[model samples]
Target: MEQISTDVAIIGAGPAGMFAVFECGMLKMSCVLIDALDELGGQCVALYPEKPIYDIPAHPAIEGAALIAQLEQQIAPFGCVKLLGRQVTGLAGEAGNFTLTTSMGDKISAKAVVLAAGAGAFGPNRPPLDGLSAYEASGAVRYYVKRREDLRGKRVVIAGGGDSAVDWALALQGVAAHIAVVHRRPKFRAAPESTAQLDALAAEGKVEMVIPYQLHALHGQDGVLQAVEVVDLDGAPRKLETDVLLPFFGLATELGPIAEWGLDLAQHHVTVTPATMETSISGIFAVGDIASYPGKLKLILQGFAEAAMAAHAIYGLVNPGMALHFEHSTTKGVPG
Candidate 1:
């Protein structure tokens, strides 16, 4: 419906996107950051925000939401040129003039494009219990629990055995009325510490651990989830009363359009130069979870480093013959 133009087009608004935005502004390049969330913060908001992240450079440990909020504040002075709550369905052209099409029927042009889409958009693979769809569409069923304070006194049934399930269980321990985790298998993919804690919860009877089972269906009355059908280990069915059915079956995020762009991906992530964070495509670069380089580390701190290099490289492309001085002297990426 409308056309916008800028120096760089950022498709996702996560950690790397935040870093890249500031970097672009420092280089005097205008940017248009498009994402599905109205407020910034990407996966931090999409996933668990209260979870402490230790690997991010200086501070040692900060909650995911806190980090995102801080990043938003840091980029506030830049004044985002354009932030649209829409998906970039398509991309055409290359450096110095890449085009992005939105789901809302809008077109934006940019000098270069950055694919900082981390893990992409993800949700649960299966609904928590049977018939929970009633509350799902009406603003009930959620995959990732971002707001810890909201779950106070609420009964939540989480499904899955991954880090997400384990993390949320711990995060919501005191906040929720009753917490239950049901996975298809007893073995979990979460860290040993997390699993051990869950085991403790199970022993304490604070958490109901349902192993080798799944939520069969949800039963609701008057447009609210009332009961859930759970199949137990011995192929038996049981019903539990639930106000909310939360399926924490990890994120099923798909790279989709980005993958179709053919930017070269190894293990479902964009491949880039470790030092430069530049991808196979000249003007298109990647800097976060969605990107990987020779010795690329997927941590947020590492993403920050990659973002810096990508910014410098982008500046070099925009302004030719400009003496680019890299701040970080140690450079050891897949060289050009």
Candidate 2:
């Protein structure tokens, strides 16, 4: 029942949204940032934080979590209100005066809005596990790992082959008593270094790996997960015991309610007028993992570029009398 307003509203506090906040702060603009996760850094926080980020310029390699920490710390210098562990259930109104409702039942309005909720909403494919919903609570199982401390001394069994799986395998190294990574295929889809590190760890007997298999049954006792049964390659059956199970099969979806906003998605980038991250809705823009221009390169660096450009456009809409931050032709984000 509470209502608030600000100069700008950001739906996500991830990398793209974080960058947008940094710029908005520099511009002395009042803004509110909201995210489904409990903190800043979307993928970095929700999926895998300890994973190294190689594409960021000037920093050859950075852990996703560390990078997010740096971002959070840097943004702290600015006075911005952060709404974590909340989802924006609905958005309505014109460009300058928009209203937002959260799943937590709080409502707010803003002059302009930015949608930078990278691939988090539509989450990991929860392929029918039968009792999945029943066992999901009690922290015995989860789709993502937020804090490393939560994993200390606990045995974990992960299912997937993407970056999240590999990143977590490496992140939970010393903390987890034991880790078993399961994938439906023999080959992994993570970056070379990440996969290489996991491979080395497995070879050194640091972790257990299962290939060409997936979860068939999730067993629990006393209202807590006890173990899991998996079918391996060649239709072999196997069972693994652990305190936790993480299924990170990569972003198992498209846009959430944003798809209802109606934007043309072609090759990851929104079909938009070049240089403008604008979507079908005027004054509304889509950037980062959710958007790409006709030929713009899709990279973390590119997402920042899109976000920066989108900010400028929003600035123009909010205050045409003021100067825009950066030029459209120029790319200026964390140049990777």
Which one wins on TM-score?
1
User: How many clashes (backbone atoms < 3 Å, residues ≥3 apart in a chain or on different chains) does model 2 have?
Assistant: 4
TM-score, every prediction = 0.86, 0.78
Cand. 2 TM to true fold = 0.78
Candidate 1: segments with Cα more than 4 A from true spot:
1-4, 104-107, 128-130, 138-140, 327-336
Q: Residue 38 CA error for candidate 1 (Å)?
A: 2.2
Q: Give the RMSD in angstroms, all C-alphas superposed, for model 1.
A: 4.5
lDDT per residue (tens digit) for residues 198-306 in model 2 = 9999999999988878888888875488888899666778889988888886566555666655557665445555577777767677777766555666577877777
RMSD of each: 4.5, 4.7
Alpha-carbon lDDT, every model: 0.79, 0.77
